[model samples]
Target: MTRYEPAVDLNAITALDVHVHVESDDHGHFALDEELLDASAAYFKGSENRTPSVQDLARRYRDAGMAAVVFTVDATTATGHPAISSEEIAQAAAEHADVLIPFGSVDPHQGAAAVQRARHLVQEYGVRGFKFHPSLQAFSPDDPAFQPLWAALEELGVPALFHTGQNGIGAGLPGGRGIKLRYSNPLLLDDVAADFPGLTVILAHPSVPWQAEAISMATHKANVYIDLSGWRPKYFPPELVRAAGGLLRRKVLFGSDYPLIAPERWLADFDDLGIDTAHRPGILKQNAAHVLGLR
Candidate 1:
């Protein structure tokens, strides 16, 4: 029952991967059901090491000389599958605190219970932040019903990382397994950001099909940020690359969407994007450090 505390030496880590998933527990329970897991593997194509446990992830990131923020999605109501325990994940991460930062997830649909659990994850277990998948969770970020959860996080003074734009979780399944892409639109989070200025909101992934909107939010809102994850750098939208080099440089962070997209592969492709030399360090590590309060 030890509370987690980061032991990472910022100087020792070359990067902080902010979007890694701990899809399984030490007990062999998976975060997502077989159908969604298989679908995501197919969608990512290069998802070679899917379903790694927290310990496995710690070794992988540590070997790479990096730190990772690991979390699992809790979409119990939407997927009808039990989620891997965020509490357990946080406790496990405490053992690998040097290279692992744990972020908790609660089914937003759980209402008051969700808020209570979020508080416990932060005040008790010491989770650094919270992760949400709007599409997979089947809830809109700006929906007033979930405002209490956001308000709780705001009060707790931790960031909220939302999966925006396209999701690979249920990709290619019938109706994408009822996971609505519309829920993940970056614009939906603009309201949440506006409403909760105290809460830092990170829009995960490139927000494809709405890259312009994502850019607009990050540029216009001080509370909003974008994480470069889920897609290879070579395939990044031109506008996003341009913004990352200039206006959004400080507001953008690096992430690998690990297990699905390895950090090694993501970094190799990032080198080819021709991003400004000045912005590289911030994107690779500094920005993430600031966002996670590691600085």
Candidate 2:
């Protein structure tokens, strides 16, 4: 059980991708079932390899001159699919510490066990943060039952990255495979940010249909941030584009939701967003550095 630690040189890296996923382990086990994986692949129309290992991610990110925060979702209770071990991911990432930063995930439905696992991941495995998929996990972020989990993350002083808005997983399937989209609404995280002010909350993706709410929450809460993942920048809502260039410049971070949306494609589209040139550096790297405590 090797502990992972980041050795990324902020000056040398062009970007920090804060939302990449480790879809498969070395043994060829996938994080999601075939149905959900197929659904997401169809939705994104992605051509890149979908189930890349930790080593694959490391090679890709290193070749691209970028650093990535990699993780796998632990939706065991909701999806009934076993998750790739975050511990193994962390240990593998330790070998490529220059490019890969591991983030741990735990099934929120596991109650106290989840909280203990989170601490173990951080303290023992050296995970820098955690990833949560409310829609896939089928839990309301504001539910009181998960407060202890949030409190534990806050106590650890690491950020909580939650999937917000529409999810590609289970998309186009009958009843969307019973994954509730309502659970991912960024507004639900408002209660969490308000309650756990010390824990940094990263609302992943654009939060379409609720972009305004996401922007409002990030604007209203000092600890709240938004990651520009899961959507091409050209498709970003006008208000979000404006906010990223102006008031929310320091509150937005770059993320490509890799494997589904390639960083190269995301960056190409981003160039067309007309963001202020002065804000580009901060949006691409500086803001994420601060949010991840790398600064």
Candidate 3:
């Protein structure tokens, strides 16, 4: 199997979408169970194909003059459902290296095995970073049991993008399908940012209900960042817009949360936010490039 290496020409791409999901494998296997999948589709009012393979993502993003960081969350142990293989995703991404950058996921509940797999994905498969969903994975980011995994990632020299705020995965289900929303609170990640100062921590989404906490963390921590994804820019909280245009411009990155929310729709709404022209390039591409070490 060929190892993944990015061949993307930075100048050719208009933006870098930092959060995109590959929900299905080339085979028929899906990343989430049918119930959760249907719930999410309904939650987003999505009529489009919800599950897109890595190749489909590459072509779509390339057609839009953009590049994307693609990944699947391994919530296998937490959900009792198998995940689409990160290894396979990375190998497939290598074939479309010009437009696809792969990020690896490991079920945090697996303890030592998770750390080893993370190392293998980065060293052998060449994943640029990692993705985590604290709620779906049923693990607290600041839990003492997971310190080793955080330490390993810090040593690996890659960022960890954690899904914070609202999640569509188990929305509207009984007890939200046993997924605890409290685990995703951005405040929980503040301890992680403090403990692992060397590790770059990306707080995904605007941290709804806790926007102040998210904004504060990214503002206070040098290694912390926020990605504007999942929600359309037109609906962004006033403070978030203010921060993105001012103090947090260099710390905010672009992400579309594709399939559920298209990049085209996200960008179209972003244009109306009236952020300063000077900060637009950094939010759209430059900041993400710096985080991904593409500079």
Candidate 4:
């Protein structure tokens, strides 16, 4: 099969939403196991079908006059649930080149194969980035076993995003269904960021209980960025709002972990943030454009 690739026309879009998911494929293949899916849905109390085809996502974003970076995480070994096809997402994005950007995810626990997949997704499929969920993927961010995976992506010049806080996947479950929150401790990534300075790292979400650490790390590391997603701005931690709206202004990018947290709801709440309207374009789009190497 031909590998996935997307040719985005940056000029055609108004905002680049950097964190969106293609939760399920058309064939009823889900990105996570059934139990986790159910548990996650319950945590969010979401009644909608979160999983939509990449084509559907393209239409959703296009209608909003926006663009999205879509990817499905591969936790095959960890979750023992086959992941949605990265190649398929990429190919679909290519078809919707007007609005979608494809990211590839690799189960770092897969070691060598993960490195190979990272290469294939970039060199062979044209993925611009990779996503990892240290908690769900069952790997410590600083583990040496996955060094090769980070090395490959770094060498390829693609950014890496890690889900870094209380995860929806296992929330409110009996024992949180064995998903360890400790694995996602944002500080663990401090070592990875230090070791792979060339790798552009994104510490996704609010990183609760460790929000201070997340903010400190992003402030200390030039290559580290934080996407404002997974939580509404009105509910934002006071410190995060201060940093994004003032202190770490350029270091923050807007991302609506769409479906779970719709863009409309996110933007509506974000509208109240005392951020200067003049900087809206930058936070909502230009910052990501700069991070993603677009204009």
Candidate 5:
């Protein structure tokens, strides 16, 4: 088994996409159930193949002259569906190290086993970070029971990216398939960030319905950051665009939430946002380089 190592030269890539999803494995396993997956596809109204493997991701990003942080959400306990193997994803990413960076996901409901798997993913597979979808995973991030997981990631010295705001998963389904939206509130993560100051906590996507709370946390906490994904740039809230240009420039990252939102489409919309050119570089790549220790 190959331990992951990043071979990509930061200078060679035009931008870094920190939020691409590896929705399927080579063996035809999907990260989410068919019903939820179909609902999300409809919500995003994206026509591209939604379930791309790691190799497909590498080719797409490489062709785009970009590097992508690829991961799958493991909500096995919550969804009762087997997750795509993160280890395999990381191993595959090793083959295309120049374009793909892997992140691992563990179901928070797994308790101590989850903590152990998280360490294994980092040490054995060389994952750069961990991904959690609080809404889909059906767990509250600030729960004391999961403190060990947060502490483990802090000691591991890798970032924990939590999906904040509205989730496309389970959208349009009756009762949203019992997925509790409250768990994804960015405020829930304020506790995690505060308790684990050493942990780099990434708030993925624009935390809609609580946009101000998300911006405030990133501004208030040095370790907190925001990845702009899930929504197209043209639809970004005015305050988010404002903060991304000014106070939060260094803490914001570029992410496409690919398959749902393509990087090409995201970049095209971002170009028209009129953010200051000086801050563009940092948001597009430099800040991610620092966060990922790629520099």
Candidate 6:
């Protein structure tokens, strides 16, 4: 099978958004359940549209002079809701290759089949990375059972992104819809980083209550990175801001958890932070380019 490479003309784009989501597939099925969706929409107060199609996102980013890495989470085994087709997302990304890069997701609970599907997504769909939600998927990243899944992605030379810290997926609900905060602990990924030396792990968001851990992981492991997303920048933990301006400058990538958190809002708040203007380009795009092999 031919691995799909996106057809984007690098010269035309100004930024590479690393953490956008394909909440709805081409078939019009949502990636999350109704109640949880409503709660998150209300929590984030998203105004730019809660759910977007791959084509819709491609057009939006292309017109905005940006490129986006897009994907849907597959939590079928955990949530009982079937996952959107990663292959379909890949096919659509190919159509709008100039602005879209596809990422793939599989419920880790499926064990070996999950690992197999991940391989298929990379080999057949041209996914450059994978997404995992520990809390929402009811799994821990350090669990020995998931080592194979991580190993397979490691072998493929594609990065694996894990949702860390506070989650809006089950936020504000009683018991957060049974999503446990412990599952998203950044410390768990430290173990994965140490165990899988070659695997590039992205710690998504600030990791909220575990911000310190996220900082330590990025500082300790050359392969671990942090994507500044999921929260408005003005509210970013002070340590994260310090790292962005200093030691973790090149390791932090700009990512707006778009549709939930708008890029305009995130960028505006980020500008107010007084980070060195010289490093802005890397945070905004170049760093992500290094991660994506786009440069």
Residues 1-295, model 1: lDDT tens digits: 9999989899999999999999899888999889988998899885667899999998899999999999999989988899999999999999999999999999999999999999999999999999999898899888899999999999999999999988898898888888899999999999999999999999999999999999999999999999999999999999999999999999999999989999999999999888888789999999999988996
Give candidate 2 misplaced runs (Cα > 4 Å). none
Global local distance difference test of model 3: 0.94
lDDT of 3 by residue, 22-54 (tens): 988989988888899899988977735699999
lDDT of 6: 0.89
lDDT, candidate 3, at 161: 99
Compared with the true structure, model 1 gives a TM-score of 0.99
Question: Model 5 reaches what TM-score against the true structure?
Answer: 0.99
Clashing pairs in 4: none
What is candidate 4's lDDT per residue for 1-295, written digit by digit as tens? 4454444566777778899989888897887777887887777766345777898898899998888989988988887888998988888888887688889998787788889888988988888899998888889988887788878888999999999988888888888878999998899999888999999999999889799999999999998999998888898999999888887788888898877888888889989999888778888888888888765
What ranges in model 3 sit over 4 Å off? none
lDDT of 2 by residue, 245-265 (tens): 899999999999999999999
lDDT of 5 by residue, 1-295 (tens): 9999999888899999999999899898998888988999999996477899999999898998999999999988888899999999999999999999999999989999999999999998999999999999999998999999999999999999999999898898899999998999999999999999999999999999899999999999999999999999999999999999999999999999999998889999999999999888899999999899897
| Model 4 bad stretches (over 4 Å) | 1-11
Residue pairs with backbone atoms closer than 3 Å in model 5 (clashes): none
RMSD of each candidate? 0.8, 0.7, 0.8, 1.5, 0.7, 1.2
Candidate 5, residue 152: how far the Cα is off, in Å: 0.5
Candidate 6, pairs of clashing residues: none
Q: What global local distance difference test value does model 4 have? A: 0.85
